[model samples]
Structure formats: C-alpha cells, structure tokens
Target: MLGRLNHVGIATPSIARSIETYKTLLGADVIGVPFDLPAQGVKVCFIDAPNTQIELIEPYDDASPIAGFLKKNPAGGQHHVCFEVPDIHAAVADMKAKGATILGEPRTGAHGTPIVFVHPRDMGGVLVELMETPQEGAH
Candidate 1:
C-alpha cells in the first residue's frame, strides 16, 4: 500500500527557471543541486515541500521522454505524483494483480529510490510512481 505523498513531479522546459520560482516565490528550504539522469533521459532537481517535495524534470535532449511531453505542452506541467511504499516489489505485485498497467520494472529514481510508474489510465488519468520509502541512494 502507499504511504506518504513522496513528491509531485513537474516536467519543465527549464529547470533553472523552475528552481528560481520555488526559491524566490515559494521560499523553498531545501533546493537540491540539479543532476543528470542519463538512463531516465532527464536533468532533474528537487525543491523541498513541507510534506513532500517538488521534482523538476527537464528533457536532457530532444530524445528525452520529457521532450515529447513538452511538445504537447510547451510550458510543461505536472508529469506525475509519487507515493511512498514500504516494499516496492510487493507494491508492484499488488498493482499487477489489480490489473494496473505498469510502465516497467522498478528502477532507481531521481532520489535514488527504487521506483516504478503505473500508467495514467489505471490511476484516474494521472501517472503514479510508487517509491520505496527511506530511499537508498543509487550511488
């Protein structure tokens, strides 16, 4: 089952601008340095939220998955909502048994946690990422 709301993922055309907005306007307390996730095909950063975090993701290149999302909404927008789970494998099995559409096998996420994404259709038109809690950093 899901735990706390882990983060709200926002795909953006410019992560720097997104970081600025969270800092200058929201006054976010913890803004992590952005880093590249070549496997995930995006450059990402985190803006701490009171209860969770805001993950700003940008296309690493035209071939980046986010590139397609940005093409649909040039301004970019909310990409997905992530939730924490105690055990990722169990969660994945449960979701599968329920007939949910899993995107792929659980993999290291931007936060370095084991994470898996379920298709939007199975989640009321919103992509859902289930993350293993107390993320073990990917190195």
Candidate 2:
C-alpha cells in the first residue's frame, strides 16, 4: 500500500521562477532541480514540505497534458497528487486488481526514483502518482 502523500504537483510556465516564489513563500529549501522527462514531455523540480514535498512541472511540448491544462487554466495550478509507496510494483498490481487504470509501467522519475501514474478515471478524476524509494540495505 502507498504510505503517505509524497508531493503535490503544480504546473508552471517557468520552473525557475516557481522555485524562487515557492522558496520565498514557504521558506523551504529547493530539494531538487528542474529536470526534463522527455518520455513524459515535462520538466520537474521539487521542494520539501513538512512530511511531503511540492513538485513543479513545466510542459516540454505543446501536446503535453500540462499544455492543455495551461490553455484552460492559465494560472498554472495543481496538477496532481503523488503517494509514496514501499513497493511500486506491488502497489501498482494492487491498483490494477482494483480495476484502476495505469497510465504506464513504472519508470524512473524525478529524484532518481521509480514511479508510475494512475489514470484519473480510476481515482475520482484526480490524477495520482505512485512513487517508490529504495529500501534500506536493498542495494
């Protein structure tokens, strides 16, 4: 099962400006730099929250989901919510068993971690992401 809310993604036009704004507003440390995920057509950066994190995403292509979102809601708002799972593969399997739709198989995400996205139809219209971190001593 997924453990906790990993992070909340916010779509932005400029990740650098968003980082600066978030850092000033939240007084948080920019934990991760914006990295482009060519596979997903988006660039992402992160800032740590109390027990979770804040993720900023920028579209790398006009056809990307964020691009569509920005077109409608130019404010560039919350994109998705992510959950941290102990075992991504098992968690995705469970979600699948529950009739949840997986967007794609697990793959490397920001922070050099493995992750997968769940279709909104299965999650009450809210896009959800499952993230996994290597277990201690799992080498």
**For candidate 1, lDDT tens digit of each residue in 15-117?**
9998888888878769888999999899999887777789999999899988999999999899999998888999999989999989999999887779999
- In candidate 2 the C-alpha lDDT for residue 51 amounts to 72
lDDT of 2: 0.83
Candidate 1: C-alpha lDDT: 0.88
What lDDT does each candidate get? 0.88, 0.83
Candidate 1 runs further than 4 Å off: 135-139
User: What is the C-alpha lDDT profile of model 2 across 37-134, one tens digit per residue?
Assistant: 87888988878777778889999888776899888878689889988888889988998999988998899877557899999888888999888964
* TM-score (C-alpha, index-matched) for candidate 1: 0.92
Q: Please list the residue runs of candidate 2 whose C-alpha ends up more than 4 Å from where it truly belongs after superposition.
A: 135-139
